[model samples]
Target: MKGYVHSVESFSTLDGPGIRSVVFLQGCPLRCQYCHNPDTWQMNEGNLVDSAEVIARVLKNKNYIARNGGVTISGGEPTAQIDFLAELLKGFKEAGLHTAVDTSGYVDLDDIDRIIDDTDLFIVDIKHMDPEKCRELTGRSNEKVLALLGHLENLHQAVWIRNVLLPGFTDTEKHISDLCAYVQKLQNVQNFEVLPYHALAKAKYQDLDLPYKLDGISEFDSKQLLQYQDMIQKYYSKKFSIQHDAWM
Candidate 1:
């Protein structure tokens, strides 16, 4: 089967463990306000390639991936194209490569189940904890996202929770505490990442002629990010008995 692919990054260090070959799949249901790859929103506007072709491309740099690193399917929400993603993950797994998916966790549970067995890691982005605020930021409710997390937990899937710290929007003590509390209950959560918000995607919005929702919002400085990370680590350590290094 052919997958609509936006692009590929051969060597990505931050996507998962060690280094990885990141596949940027096309199409996303959520219109996240801070999305940098706005061009990947359209399902039909990408290079259609068979799973073999994509796998071949990744294998070209197999040595670089080594054991700790492998392949990651990102998007435009990779699970939006479930069949193709499943096929791609199967191919990666068969090749002895660690597979990871970077998703918003807004996909249907069935779609996720189709590829979960083949996936090694899930980098889930939790936009916002509050349902209304989640809708405001991502143009979708958090119900499906939360449900996806629950499903993954039920299956005992390994997951890395990623939260974007948007100042004045999602970076409040109430929000962080609530999120930490909820995450602490998930037994399958392997890591927690607090990503600082940035305006790097504003130019992309301008290029795509799309209205930038967070136009005036300023990016958080290093100090703010460090503080948030410290707070989150402290909460996780104290409440869940998971060390900061274990999840970070």
Candidate 2:
């Protein structure tokens, strides 16, 4: 088996638990406005490597994973190549490695199940609670994403819900409140991470020759992020905290 891979980041820490190898799969179905990986959205475009070839490299980093965390698959939307992802996860699981997938939940439930059975963690991104706003922010509606979340819940899969806190897009009080309320209903959610938006990917957009959509949009204020974090905690606090240090 083979997969189209955009890039590989060995010894990545922020993607998942401890140390991890992040396989950035190519191709994404959703066009997110604040996407840092805009260059990865192109379908059928990337270096094709056989499963064994990739596994060989992954094994080299096994010690790092064991000592820290494990392996994490992030992507333009890893679900875009579902079967390849499942096979890769199977390899890692058999090696006794902790596996996690960072996804937008935009793929089919069948595909999700194929990998979820082997995956230990699901870092799901819920862009917006309002369907229309979700569609506007990311060219696709949240129906499929939400459906996938429901499936995870029903199957009792562990999940960490992530919402990129954007200034004008996803920071409104009404939206955050609704999102927190919705998340509270999901008993399977192990944690919630609120990521503050940064313009660190602006140069990447230029490199890809793609127009930067939120040019004038400033970075989210640290103070506001805490406000939202506190608000969300008020509703769902089993495990909720800022990605970095406490905002205040």
Candidate 3:
């Protein structure tokens, strides 16, 4: 199977456990206002290549990934091209590497089922808890996101929940509380991370000729992130550490 690939990170310690090879695929459904990789929005823009070709490249750097780390197929919403993603995941498994998919979770269960078995972990992004608020920020409803999360729960799939802390939108007390409440419902969550927002994508938006909706927003103070752990403990009890150290 073939798919459009935006880029590749040969050694990324922040994308997942240990060191990993990150396959940045092209295409995303949600137009997240604070998105950093706006270049990946167009489905057909990136270089098209077969799954085997991508796998071969990743395996070439396999020794760099060592034992714990493996492969992560990230996106512009990787699930946007389910068949291609499934093929890549299947290849990773056949090669005896741990597999993971970093997704927005705005996907159909049927589509997710294609790669679910092969994926060792799911790095899910939960943008907003309120459907209307989610729509306002992402230009899409959170219904599909929640549905996909629920499906993963049923399968007892390993999940790492991620939420970007946008200053005015997602950093409010109510917003965080609502997110914590929802996360409490799931018993299979391995980690819950609140990513501090960064406006490093300003130039990218300007270059792409797209309006930067989060124009004046400043980067979040990551040091203050520890306070959220106490808030999360009120509703759920599990790991609540910062997982996006790569951005730092």
Candidate 4:
């Protein structure tokens, strides 16, 4: 099968464990205000690669993956290319490679299930706690995402939940507390990450000829994070830190 790809990072440390082959698939339905990879939102706008080619490259990095971590398929939304991912992950599994899918959780349950069957870990981005806010922030409702989480829980799949903590947009006290409460209901949640928003993607919006909505917005402060962290920690027993990579 063929998949549209925005780009590929051969060796990435922050994407997963030790070193990982991160495939940035193209096309997304969401219109996140703080999206860094604005260029990836367009469908069929990137390189077209065969699953066999991807698997071949990933196999060559097995030593690094075995030593560090594994391959993580990130995207404009990996579920958008479900069949391709299923094939790629199956091949990786055959080669004894650990596979992860980093997604927005906006997909058909059947497609997600197929990928999950071949996947080892699921790294998901929970856009918002409030359905209304979620719709506003991502151009769609969060019902599907919430349902995806519930499905993962029911299947006992390991998941790493991530939230972009945009100070004014997403870091409200009520929102954080609500998300904390919701996460408490899930099982097999391996980690929870709080990603603070930054203007690193402003240039991308400019290049795409799109308006950068969150312009002039300051990054989150230490105190703000502490307040939200304390609230989330009340529900989340596992502690997580802010990502420090260039992509964060």
Candidate 5:
């Protein structure tokens, strides 16, 4: 099956462990106000290519990626196109490349079950824990996301949880503390990160004729990440890092 692709990054260190070939699939269910790539919001708006084609292109750098990293299926929301994502993940695995899916975990269990076996890791986005706040930020409740996280925990799937710390939203002390505590309950967490929010996508929104929802919000200072690290480190004693411009 063909997948609608927003773009592809041949090499990326931020999406997952080691170096990775990141495939940005098209479409999303939520309209996250601080989304950096609003250009990828539409499911049918991108170039369509066969899953085999995407696999072949990524495999070209197989010697390096396979040895160091692997393939990462990221998106607007990779699971939005379940069939295409499954095909791509399966293809990556069959070719002996490690595979990871970076997603919002906004999809249903049955839908994502297709790729669970093929996916070696899941980088789940934690938009906001409060249902109302989450809905306000992304136009959806946090129900699905929570469910997906629980599912992954039950399966013992390796996960990297991330939250974009936006001002007046997810940057609150209570939010960070609760988020950190919640993550501690998971057994297979590989990484926990807080992506510093930035207004880097304002230009994209302006170009797309979409209103910059967060027009006045200043870029989140990278230094503020340290305070959060210190606060959450008590709960998350494993791997935690201050994510700069690297989170999707």
Candidate 6:
């Protein structure tokens, strides 16, 4: 089967463990205010590549990505093209490679179930903890995203939680506390990351003739991000069995 692919990165250290070949698939259902890749929102804008072609690309870089790395199918939401993602992950798994998916976790349960067994890890992005705020930021409710987390926990799937700290928006104590509280209950959560928001992609929005909703919102400094991370770690340590050091 073929999938709409926006781009590919041969070596990505942040998307998953070790060095991975990241596939940026096309299309997304959300119009996040802080979204950097507005270019990927269009489902039909990318090139259609067959599963074999994608697998071949990963195979070519197998030597470098073999140890702790493999393939990470990221968005525009991988589940948007469920069949292709399932086929790609299955092919990579059969080749003895670890596979991961970086998603917003807004996909339908049925689509996710189809590829769950073949997936090694999930980098789930929680846009916000409050339902209203989540909807305001991403044009979608937090219900599906949170539900996906619970579903992954029930399936015993390893997950890395990513929360972007958008200052004056998602950087509030209440938001972080609520998020940590919920995440602490999930036994399958392996890592919790706090990513600081940046306006680096503003130019991309201009190039695409799209509005940068986060315009004028200053980026958080490293120190501020560390403070937020410290708060999250402290809360998780106090509320969960997992140690504070487990967070990233």
TM-score of 5: 0.97
TM-scores of all candidate predictions against the true structure = 0.93, 0.94, 0.94, 0.94, 0.97, 0.94
Which residue pairs show collisions in model 2?
18-69, 19-69
TM-score of predicted structure 4: 0.94
lDDT of 6: 0.85
**lDDT top scorer:** 5
Model 6 TM-score (2 dp): 0.94
Clashes, model 2: 2
Q: Which has the better TM-score: candidate 1, or candidate 6? A: 6
Model 1, span 1-248: residue lDDT tens: 99899999899878888989999999999998878789999998899999999999999999999578999999998988999999999999999999999999888887887887899999898899999999998899899889989888988999988887778778898898889988989999988777667777788888888999888888766676678777777667633221222111
Lowest-lDDT window of 10 residues in candidate 6? 239-248
Output the lDDT of residue 130, model 6: 84
Q: For each candidate, how many residue pairs have backbone atoms clashing (under 3 Å)?
A: 0, 2, 0, 0, 0, 0
Instruction: Give candidate 3 regions above 4 Å deviation.
Output: 222-230, 233-235, 243-248
lDDT of each: 0.85, 0.85, 0.86, 0.82, 0.89, 0.85
Q: Write the per-residue lDDT of candidate 6 for residues 169-201, one digit (tens) a residue.
A: 788888878888888888998887777777878
Among the numbered candidates, top TM-score falls to 5
The model with the greater lDDT, 1 or 4, is 1
Write the residue-wise lDDT of candidate 2 on 207-245 in tens digits: 888898899998757687677777777777577767753
Q: For candidate 4, write residues 1-248 as lDDT tens digits.
A: 89898888888877766789888888888989888998888888898999888888877878877665889998888788777878888988888878899989899898987777788898889999888888888899999888899999999999988888886767777887787778767878887778888788888888879999899889877787677777777666666766634343
Model 3 clashes, total count: 0
**What C-alpha lDDT does candidate 1 achieve relative to the native structure?**
0.85
